[model samples]
Structure formats: C-alpha cells, structure tokens
Target: MRITADRTRCVGSGLCAERLPDVFDQDDDALVLLCADEVPAGLRQDVEEAVQRCPTEALSLDADAPEH
Candidate 1:
C-alpha cells in the first residue's frame, strides 16, 4: 500500500504518529510527516489504522495502486 497526507487538511493532532510511530511522525512544527510512503506488507494494517483515526481525514492510502 501507498500512503499520503494532505497538509492543508491536517490539524497537527499527532494521532497518526502516536498510533504508528514507525510510519508517521511530527515535524518540529508538529505537522504530520509520512515516514514511509511505500508501506511494507507488515506495516499495512497499522498504517490503515492510522489513516482511519485521522480526525481531519488528511491521511489517505492507495491500496490498489502498484508499488513504486
């Protein structure tokens, strides 16, 4: 799966980072940062959870897309 975030829609809530630190993080300004755009199979489930928990719906996953 591939994941991306829309910064304009983010609220700096940090929930994604909290739920999946290995794939998400907060910059110095506390904006959401994607640590891994091309998710490995092992981390797909956790990444999906993070996307679902995003309050502002800033996180997105393209599960059907071909891996880059």
Candidate 2:
C-alpha cells in the first residue's frame, strides 16, 4: 500500500502523527507531512487507522499504487 497526504485539506490535528509517528508528521505550519509514501507491510493496519482518524480526510491509503 501507499500513503498519501493532502496538506491543503489537512487540519493539523496531529492524530496521524500521534498515532503513527513513523509514517506521519506535522510541518512547521502544522499541516500533515508524510514521512514516506511507501507503506511497510507491518504498518499498513496502523496507517489505515491513522488515515481513518484524520478529521479532514486528508490522508489515504492506495493499494498497489504506482510510484509518482
């Protein structure tokens, strides 16, 4: 799976970063920042949870998506 974050849509709630700091973070402006686009096999479930918890729905998981 691949993780994607839309900063423009982010509310900077820090839920993703708080839940899974390994994959998500906050920029200086407190917007969502993706630590990595590629999701490790073990972290997929946690990442999904984080995405779902995002209040702004700015985070997403794309299964088997091609690299940009």
Best by lDDT: 2
Per-residue lDDT over 1-68 for candidate 1, one digit per residue giving the tens place of the 0 to 100 score:
78899988988999998888888889888889988888766887788888899999999998798844
Cα shift from native, residue 41, model 1 (Å): 2.8
lDDT computed for candidate 2: 0.87
Tell me the TM-score of each prediction against the true structure.
0.87, 0.90
Predictions in order: lDDT: 0.86, 0.87
Q: How close is candidate 2 to the true structure, as a TM-score?
A: 0.90
Report how far residue 4 has shifted in candidate 2, in Å.
0.6
Clashes of each: 0, 0
